[model samples]
Every structure is written in C-alpha cells, then in structure tokens.
Target: MMSNQNSVQSGFLPIPSIRRTVSPSQALSRSLATALVLALLIFVLGPLVVLVLWAFAGEWFYPSLIPQKFSLSWWSTVLSDSHFGHSVLLSFIFAPVVTILSACICLPAAYAFSRYQFPGRRAMFIGIFATNAFPKMGLYIAIAGILYATHLMDTFWGVIVIQLMNTVVVMTWIPAAAFSAVPKSLEEAARDVGAGPFRTFWHVTLPMARPGIIVAMIQAFLASFDEAQGTFLVGAPNYITMPVQMYSMVTNYPQQAAAVYSILLSMPSLILLLLIRKYIVGGYLAAGFRMK
Candidate 1:
C-alpha cells in the first residue's frame, strides 16, 4: 500500500503502438485473403461487366478499353426482334409450368420420404440422389433417344419433360430436407389441439418448411429457364428457348445485340433472387439428409 502511493502512474499505456496491432504475418495473410476474394469476384463478374459495356458500346475497337461511342441501338434491335420475343414467351411459359409440375409431383414425394418408413426407402432415396450425381449430358442423350422412339422428341411437351427431369433431384432432395427439419413435437401439438392431419400439416408443418420449398421452387424454375444443353438436344429445331437462342445470336448477331439479350435473359432470375435472397442459403436446403 505504501509502494502503490509512490508508483508512477501513466494515463495511457507506454506500449500503445503495439496494443491494437496484429503481427506482420497475420496482417499479410489478411491482405492476401482480401486480394484473392477480390480476384475471384473479378474473375466471375468480369465477363458480365464486359457484357454490360458491350451492350452499349457503339464503336469499341481492339485498342480501346472503353467504347469510343455509346448508343441504345442494340437494345432497340434486340427488343424489336420477333425471335427474342418468341423465346421470352416460351421461357416464361415453360419455366412456370415445370416449376408447378415439379412442386406437385415432388413435394408429396418429399413429405413421404421425410415422414414415413417403408421397405427400400433408403435405396430409392439413393437412386434419386444419384440421378444428379453424374454428368447430365449423357442422360440427356439417352433420354433423347428414348424420346425419339416414344415419338416425344422435338415436341413442346418433350422439352418440358427434359427440363422437368433436371428439376426432380433438386425438388426432392431440398424439400425432403426441409420437411424433415420440421419438429415432430410441434406437429403433434397441433394434432393434439384438435387439428386434423391436413390442418396440422397446412398450418404447422408447411409454414416451417416453406423456406426450403421456396428455395426448391426457385432452383427448379431457374434450372428449367436456363437449361440449354437438354433443350438444345431435344427442342432445338422446333422449340428454341432463350438460352438456345443465345447460341444462335453468338454466331449470327452483333456482340451488342447478344449482350443486350444476355442481360434480358438474366433479369428474371436476378430479380427473383434479390426478392427472396434469404431462402437460397444452404442451411434451409441441405440440413435434412439423415433419413432412416
């Protein structure tokens, strides 16, 4: 106590320089990590940035980093084209139809897999999981051959079937997880409180699983709308959609027109993604794989 009174007290630490500082290696590593993330984002978004630039570039040349002139002529040409309009119409029609059908067919199946026990259930789940584990091009080819034999190839319905095939795995796997994640006790509580099975499910179960279902639906819609390889193989000459049309534009139309079309093609998915961004995270969709 006597020494304490005689001690030299400072208002701040003498080593203030080192107080909030990281070691050199940590700082370097943090800087490098930030740089790598920026590089990766640039790598991914670089082409998209160029597309936006090229869409408005009227007189870009090899030496120019930016366009020498800018104009809205490309947007006009793309918007005015009959083929672009038709492709848009077909995409809007087909994507929604595929999403609805997938929900109807797969949502019940997901619920069954989640809530019921049956013989061969595990094996059936594995089979469904494995459908998306392989490269889809080979499957598309096999399906195309089958479609040809079945007299379904090159038809609108055939195209729908092809797109729907892509969606089955997503719809089943994600919603299965979502449905399985719902607490059994809450469902039971609903039933015990005079709720019927359907009412219990509609009120208690469905709301809890809605995020996963929405994620599944969004994935299905985008898969159908953006699918090019299957659509190309099955519906090329007869039912050319937006993605398939992009192939033609790349080879035939000016870069600017293709850029404008690319932006337009991307708008719907982007808009939807922005609106319901929360549901698209992996947690809602991937937390349900331990079904016994």
Candidate 2:
C-alpha cells in the first residue's frame, strides 16, 4: 500500500487543498460572477440548442429532454421548398447591393468626418448615429408612409433603402475612426514626393484603413442580411428575403422546418464573422472619438 501510494504521488502532481485563504467577500464575488456567466450562457445559447434539436428531431414530445429519434428530413424539407432558393437569392442580392451602396455613400462621409472640420460636423455625426441608437420600428413606419407617397412602396429601391439604413451607422463610424487613425504625415509625405491628393489618399491613407473598412463591410452585410422586420413590412408579398421567410415559416410551417430554416439563414452571417473574426477587434472601434 505504501509503495503504491508513493508511486502514484511521485508520478502525478499533487492536488491543492479544498480549503483556501480567500476572503468571504472574494468568494461571494467569484460565485456571483460564475452564476452570472452561466445565466448569460443559458440566455444566449439555450434557444440555439433547442433550435438545433428541433431541426433534427423525428418524434420529440413534451416531458422529454431529448428527441425519440433523429433524422435529416427537416433539412431536406427546408432545402426542397421552392421559396427557399428565391429567398436566398433575394438575400444575397440585397445584402451585397446594399453593402456596396452603403460603402460608396458612407465611406466618403467617413473620410470627410475624419479629414474636414465643417459646420454641424459633430451634429451630423450624432444625427447619423441617432438613426440607429433609437428604436427603428418607428423609423420604418415613418419611412413606409413616405414610400407610399413617393410610389416607392413594394419596389426594389424601397427595400434597398430600408436595409441600407441599418448599415449607415456602423459603416460610417468604423471607417471614420480608421481614416482618423491614418497619420497625416504619411499622406503629406506621399504628396511631397509627387503623389496627387487623390493618389496619396489611395496609396497611403486607404490601405492603412482597410482593416476597419473590411470590418465595417462585414457588419453592413450582416445587418442587411439579417434584417427581417422592415423587409417584412415592405417586401412581404413580392420580395421575401431569407430572414423574412423565417418569419413566415414560424407561423405557417412546422416548427422543425422553421428550425432548419433558421440555421440556414444564420450560416452566411456566421461564416462571414468567422472569416473576418480577427479584424473585428475593438481597437479601431475605440478610435471613433479620436475622429475630429
């Protein structure tokens, strides 16, 4: 017995004592923090777990924590739906088109915000930000009224305009901060060496800001891609995008089909986020206030 104990003790590291010198307050704080994190995990991930189960469940019922059987029929049904392909096409078209348009409009605004000092500059920035900071349902309703007047209702441009609204704030703010971070001296040095203002900006300033711009573009794409509420209000009958299709599936289709569809809707945004995960850091975002 002594030999076995000695061998085991020598082979493996010793375990620490269960008793610790931690203060009562510290112990309470640690326990509270752990509980909070656990709660947050449940809040965020619990539905996802349920959704994933429902997507594959063959005969799940009440009073059960798991399915009786699992199959790929849910996925097959979701994939086979005629509207599925159309919804995906609409999402792809809308997200990228809106992203491109947003980049064109907001990038120049971002550059101006970073480089120029004009009247109402801060106010303009605030106004742009306030569009997103406040509740959007009201804005969508108001915009719907205007669209009705302009005969833009149920039109492609109308839907594009709505999705574009969500992208504006992130697209402008991040790139503005990025452009502000580019050293003025480098741009000046390029100009001094015979580069024109535009050339200098292209070569020196823009490349340095590419990371933040990439991050912004990804955000804009996701925002437009995931947008369902406004799209539903305007484009329901004619232009049902993927997210909007999810809304329809929730009420009209089987819960399992909806689960399968939800995961499909989420794939592009998840893939994009994972691809650009490194660039979506807080460093560039924190530079927003540094923009003058």
Candidate 3:
C-alpha cells in the first residue's frame, strides 16, 4: 500500500527539464551576427547622428562628444521658408501622381509579361532595366534635353514624366514576378463559374497579388520622393520638389538646414512604412523573397 501510494505521488511529481547549451559553431555564428549588426548600425547612424547634432547645435566645434549649445533657430528658419513649404507640397502632389501613373503603365505591361510568352520578352525586360544602367547624370542630361525640346521644362507634368524613369521598370518587374507566382488554375476556376476576364482578375487574381502591388507602389513613391538629380535638372528654377530643394540646401545652407530637410524628407516615408508594415512584410513573403 505504501509502495503504491509512493508510486502515485511520484506519478504526480514534475520532471526537471534539461537546458540546452549552445554549440561552439552556433556561439561563433551568433557573435559574428551581433558584431555585423552593430557595425552596420554604427556605419549608417554615425553620420545621421552628426547631422542631428549640427541641426540643433549653436557653436559646435572639434573635440566635443556633445554639442556646446543647442538651439531651435535652425528649425524656426526652415519652418519659415516658403520655398521649403512649396517643395514639400510639390512632393506630396508629385509622389502620388507618379505612383498612380506608374501603376497604370506597369500593371498592364506586367500582366502581359506574366500571362503571355513572346519573342524578345526577356530582351525587352533587359532593355527596360538597361535604361537605369547608365550613370544617372548622363541619363538625366539626356532626359532633360528631351524635356527642353518638348517645351515641358520646369513644368509639373515634365517632372512627372521624368519620375516615370524611376518607377516603371522596377514596378513592372516585381508585379510580373508576383503574377507569375499566382496559380493559373484559380483564374480558370473563376471563369468556370461564369466570371469574365476582368471580373476574374478583379475578384481573384488582384486580391492574391495585392501585397506585391502595394509594395511596388510604395517603392515607386519612395523613388520619386528621393529623386534629386533628375528633378533638379528637369524642373529647376520653377518647380522644385523636396529632394531637389534639399540637395540645393545641403550645398549652400548651414548643416542645420540640411538636417531639417533630411527629417522632413524622411518623415513621410517612415510614417508610411509604419502604417503599411504588414503589407510590406506580406509582399516580401508572397513574392517568396527573403527579408534579409
């Protein structure tokens, strides 16, 4: 009876768990990864840190780990500049316009590439990407000359046209891949249920590919938002976007002004990414692309 009772008690007792130890290889790999991450953070953030310091610093000089004095005068100056406000407005206007137009142009092209096979298809994609292969300066100069000849120089429409160069090829490439990854059977299933091509695409394929399309549009907007050289050359002295304005400010104004502009340029993208982080992650996953 005692043995039986003891056995019963033992059955109810919990077992002690064994802890897993890190292997030497795993430990080494972990150390290397941590070091690499730290290195990357420092490399990228060091200059940005300095820029921030300069933005608020009054009389910062050498050999100081921190600024001597901080002031909001630079911030005030940047805020008061009407040209800066205009630049921000222009970016807000042009970035979305560019994104919309690029989507319209790319969606059909991407669908065609993914849905059909034709001669020189691969060559055509290569040609599209090849346009960006040239140095940006040379490309911008060529584009600017065309804009000037067409009398589109210094116009909003002209800038929008030039911004297409930033978006079209890449957006098409991504959506094409995403579309190819989607199974054709799904579309056929939709059709068998009496749905037309447009309805099938709208109801079936588009939702499946929404993640990739969202990512492509976001990328296109960012490309236009950060576009400097092409916009500066094509829309100079008339319609300056935020990036072009910042490029000029960085060269001629104090570091503080550059810092202010940097923050302004970055805020919209950061906010946008935060809002659609799930879509970005989903897009990468749906496209079978690894984040790292």
Candidate 4:
C-alpha cells in the first residue's frame, strides 16, 4: 500500500515539475521578444536621435557619443535673422501651393485610371512610371531651357510648375488606390436611387476617398517643401526656398544650418505623419474593399 502511495505522490510531483519547467521557457520567450523590439527601435530611431543631438551640439566633429556642451545659440541666430524668416515663409507658401496644384491635376486623372477601362491605360501608367527612372539632374538643362523660352525661368511660377509635374505623379497614385477601393455596388445603389452619375460620384465616391486624398496631399506638400535640386536649379537670385537657404548657410554656419533648418524642415512632415498615420494604414488595408 505504501509503495502504491509513493507512486501516486511521484506522479503528482512530476506534474508540478512540468509546470515549473514551462515557466522558464515562457520567461525566456518574453525576454527574447523584448530584446527584438528594442533592437528594431534602435535601428529605426538611432539616426534621428543622432541627428537631433548633432543639431544641438556646439560643434559637429565626431569622436564623442554625446556632445560636450549644448546651447540654443544657433536657434536664436536663425530666428533673429530676417533671411531665415523669409525662407520659412516661402516654404510654407509654396508647399501648400504644390499640394493644391497636385490635387487638382491628379484627382480627375486618378478617377479615370481607377474607374474606366481606357485603350492605353496600362501603357500610360508605364510611361508615367518610367519618368521616375531618369535622374532629376539629367532633365535640369532641358527644363531650364524650356522655362527660359517660356519666360518662366528664375521665377516662383517656374519652380511651382516644375515641382507640380513631379508631385502629381505621387499624388495620383495614392488617390487612385483610394478611389479603386470604393465599392462599385455603392455607385450602382446610388444610381438605382435616381442619382445621376455626377451626383453619385460627388456623394458616394469622394467621401470614401478622403483619407487617401489627405495622405496624398501631405506627401506632395513634403515633396515640395524639402525639394533641393529642382528649387536650386530653377529658382534664381532672389527666389529662395528653405532648402536653398539651408544649403547656402552650410558654408558659413554649418552648425546653425543643421540646428535650425533641419529641425524646421522636419516639422511639417512630422506633424502630418503623426496626424495621418492611422488613415494611411487604414487606406492600405481597406484597398480590397472595392472588390466588394
């Protein structure tokens, strides 16, 4: 009887041992997952942290993980200067203009591409995408010559026109995806309810595409805001944008340039990204909704 009792006790003890064994494994898995997340965070945010550090550093020669001293002198200098102010104002003005122009031009084009089966739709998309392959610098001379001939060279409108062409491509792709995500059934239902084609589109189609449109607008705005080569190549003498101003400042005030303009340049993008991050992700996932 005692031997049988001992055997039963042993079995119960083994069950506890098995439970104890799982605890360590679970703990180890949690630790590994934490480590992996930390690694990814460092990989993504490390450069941005370093950039922020360097921007505030009194001098930017490497050899130290941290700056010896920090100061707001550079920020002060940038804010006090009228030139920086003007450049900032220019960026704010032109970025919106570019965004608006891109939206106006791309909306109809995106609608057509998404809704209609045109003869050369595929070819047209291919041709448009092909333009991205050529280096921007390669087109500079030709663009400059054309602008000069058209009396738009060295003017604000010239920069706007040039930037508009590039911005429209990106803007169109986002909204086209958004538009394509809208349900055909929705339009059909609207039509069945006695709505005209224009009324159905205005009421049913556009509201669904709003998230994508917002994302596209933000993208186009950032593109024009940070544009360096096109703005430098086309904008001349007195027509200066923030990036151009920052470039010029690099020669004379490298630390100040990095500190002030880099921070300023990043703000619009950062704010917009934070605001629309959810919408962008939602739009991407909801792209399959059109099939319904």
What are the RMSDs of all candidates, in order?
4.4, 6.0, 6.8, 4.4
Q: List the residue pairs that clash in candidate 3.
A: none
Candidates 2 and 3, the one with greater TM-score = 2
Candidate 2 — worst ten consecutive residues by lDDT sum? 13-22
User: What lDDT tens digits, residue by residue, belong to model 4 across residues 101-176?
Assistant: 8888888988888999989887776566655666777777678999999999889899998778677666767788
Q: How far off is residue 201 in model 1, in Å?
A: 0.4
Estimate the lDDT of model 1. Answer: 0.88
* Model 1 error, position 291 (Å): 6.7
TM-score of candidate 4 against the unseen true structure: 0.82
* Better by lDDT, candidate 4 or 2: 2
Model 3 C-alpha lDDT per residue in residues 161-277, reported as the tens digit of each score: 888888976688778877876899999999999999999999998888777777788888988988988888888888788988987898899877888778878898888778668
Model 3: which ten-residue window has the lowest total lDDT? 13-22
**Of the candidates shown, which would achieve the greatest TM-score relative to the real structure?**
1
Give the winner by TM-score: 1 or 3. Answer: 1
TM-score of each: 0.91, 0.86, 0.83, 0.82
